[model samples]
Target: MNEANNHVFDTTTGEEQHLSKRNGSSNGTSKNGVANKIPSISEIKAAIPNHCFKSTIKQSMYYVFKDIILIIALYCFGHWVLQCNSIILKTALSPVYWFLQGTLLFAVFVLGHDCNHGSFSSYALLNDCLGTVLHSFVMTPYYPWKISHRHHHNNTGNMDKDEIFYPIRKKDNNKNSFALFFGLGFGWLAYLWRGFGPRQMNHWIPRHAIFAKHVVGCILSIGVVGIWVGILGYYVQLMGMVSLVYHYMIPVFICGCYIVMVTFLHHSDINLPWYSDDNWDSVKGKLSSVDRDYGIFHDVIHTIGTHQVHHLFPIIPHYNLREATTHFRKAFPQLVHINDKSIFPAFTEMFFKYSSQCIVENDAKIHYYK
Candidate 1:
């Protein structure tokens, strides 16, 4: 660890306090080996160039238009493949089409993520409008999911409050293995239908406790999703079930897999810490995230894998995250946690170890996956 740069925020006074100043220990290591001090949000933000925080409508829309054009082109090519007489060729090519289509759709969801953060553009109405359309197309309820997601951001790594990818308490039964397995394909949907962790309210139900503060936004998102479903049904009727399955259902399932996997990976590492409210704060929660390298798909999904910086400063647009992350690492090298493991092998290891790693002591003020 970089002892000279180690610092923790004084939340009450909103000032930076060096860890060495608080105690005789020259380094900020706790008995458990985790760093005791974390950089404040302000300190991290000041490290990045101010231009990275600016979001322009034209620049954001360019990526949107680019994705839309590619999706259309892929759709056209897939349609042409449907007319091919060779069954072997279709069998060989189907998976390729599904992978590409689903990946791009997940990228679209990343764009919606920016909208929810108000990083896609300066206008609130514009952000809401784009978020609703993007999420609905990806089979998600926009504002309801957005509201819950905001809760997740605000309460990340908080044992009693985090909305998703929350650690399993040791006192709870080990039955979560099945739920974790199912999560890869349908977790996002399940979370929206019913809540996750300590929040038990349904996102689709505007009157649900989770949506109590944002009922109007929730209802509007639900209505938009309903309309999207109607359009999907009409498309199925016009194009037949096989076409719908080939082009829509399979790809949507693929996108869902990506969404769940990326989210789970960002928060569920075996070494990451979870805190009780007594020790939890926004700075600590944001630093709890891990930055993973997705290789070629990194930029394909809009640099979302550069997650630590995004969590620390979501106002930084996706396009500017890489530069912001560069500065963040230089500013506080010890604080930035990057997981360089290859995706497939890493996820496989985490999968088998999840039930064990996710369970933390029920009474501990700070918990780590054991």
Candidate 2:
């Protein structure tokens, strides 16, 4: 941790500058109704080429090496910057390094995500091993998250089954719930401790007294992360608390926050739709997610913004997602939704969705955000 930098991020105002300007949208209003009929899962799968589903160890390792090297390099750079003697230089430059450090770790999150889906490598053992390592660094329980995330994909648009972000009738929504929308940017912390999002757990931290689904895995992950904390303890002992806090703790917290915000923006927006029973189609469910641009950080975060395509075909590796999305859009133009606009508008979109647009009324049979 860099002792020169210290503080948490204020996401209330939000990262308006992080959003990119996009060109198109998916606007199917309730009044207009949804597709006369829903497409089958196989039909949707056929839309994407077979090659998109393939993964190779050589290619996967390349990305793993690339992302790991970049994360290490960013930390190294931050450490050097903190060594400057001038107070003015340290104050101004240190935050930039911290931001870059946090952002790079967000890329690490993408790699872990790929492993979660078994998309990072062809070998299951390799994927699990890498996933454990990457997830431990960021303090995520790999097995628990992987299982719940499966639930999310299985019942994506269903009003009831969808694990997280499941919508209630407009009258049923908690209008006064500030904590609900707070996760838009800072939700990762709340989620880490008290499970939120599409995860299966009702509470973030499970009770050990009862029979928890992944107790052994969760305990193991905690122990693994404890090792990381122990490493930080070594640094704190060497340079005092300030150094560890600034260089690692604060920045890494920001990294988790970044993951939450990015995930939030993709799935939680005004234009996207949620469905129930006959209304829910596999293709539409996948298309319901929006893909935003993070400007230059798009590559830094491993093109996670290419989300709609990723959801449709989770087998596609992160490094290949951008190219796959291009083919996806060309194949199903009407099914694609893109909002590569800046975070400012996305913030407004989220604000409106959470504030006034809290529920699904009789307004749409498809059950979209009001």
Candidate 3:
């Protein structure tokens, strides 16, 4: 296992990433090495530059301002679209706003996610403030989700310790698997409220002390949301329930579904494994997930699609995610998982295996998606 100098090259171009030798197959896993024997997460982190770990307040503010302005501009444009003189034109064009606006909302949600990771800015308070507001706008209970997310990263690949996104045990089959697949998009809402998805994470471990400080922030966010709802209610009265549902709720639903699906795919893709304690450690925990490219929308949404690097070094800001991902893939070329075939097709493949092949047998040493 002394693979410190192994060099992995890109299979397609055969280009050298100027990094380590690859450990396994074309897919990234090590055939000779057991699941637990990959390089350590600390080793991976050390390979990344020190500056990747640092953040600047000014740069963070620039992104914050940029996302906010974009969301506002999108909203105003939606309003203008709604006021189109011809009813037919207005009705036809409104969903466009919902899709674009809801996507922007999720864009800022990524910003908040960066804040939650303490990677958005050097100032902890500022990150907290922005994260709380941005997540709240998307109906996420900020502090609660933040603390839970911390648990998730801390124990990403340990099936028992991992807070959310853990797979079902093989013997634990139930009638709900199909239902769960159909409803996967609502996973985020379920995670936040019902404790349904990701195994009702908060119910198992309530971080009371951590949540207390942010209770006021959560409440204030609710108040702000109440105001937004009031505005929506006003529109509902003017536009009717069907119109509101079509233009507002559906778009938001689309965005929420997309977020959760992407999150699910990050960890549950083909060949990734969830380990028992004997086989579990930091490096495998990171390698357990994959990164995706979202094509055109990639940059606008932050480099969140470059998720493997983010999971390993959550402190790396979104602006630096692409660079960090490149460095990591080159360094650990054997360990990095990329979906070059396209996002949706790959998601379809992984998610299908996720439902069918990922069940953990009770007596197995290690479990992976089939």
Best candidate, lDDT: 1
Off by over 4 Å in 1: 1-33, 170-176
> In candidate 3, what are the lDDT values of residues 1-370, reduced to their tens digit?
2344244332222222223443433334354222323677778887788888888988877887887898778767776776669898778878777877777777878888899999988788888877877876676666677776787898888876676557656565453654444365476666666554335444223434545665665566556566667878899899898767755676667678768777876776545668876667876786667677788878878877888888888999988887787778657666755554477676676667666765666655666664
**Deviation in Å, model 3, residue 351 alpha carbon:** 2.3
What does candidate 2's lDDT look like per residue over 1-370, in tens digits? 1221111111222111111222222222222223334457576667666778888888877777887787778777777777778899888988888888787677777788899898987888788778878877776766566666766777776675565656656654544465644654356656656554323353235563232676776666667777877887887889889777777776777787687677667776654677765677567677677777889888878888888778878888877788787766554444555665587567666756755554667444565554
TM-scores of all predicted structures: 0.89, 0.82, 0.81
- Give candidates' CA RMSD values in order: 6.0, 9.2, 4.8
1-370: candidate 1 lDDT, tens digit per residue:
3666655322112233454463223245443324566777888889899999999999999989998898889888888777799999888888999989999999999999999999999899999999999998998888988888888899988887898767666675455454755476577677767666545657777566667787888888889989998998999889988988888888888899898788878876655677888889999888887788899989989999999889988888999999998888667755655666787676766666665566667876887653
The CA root-mean-square deviation of candidate 3, after full C-alpha superposition on the true structure, stands at 4.8
Candidates 1 and 3, the one with greater TM-score: 1
> How does each model score on lDDT?
0.78, 0.66, 0.68
Ranking by TM-score: 1, 2, 3
For model 3 the TM-score comes to 0.81
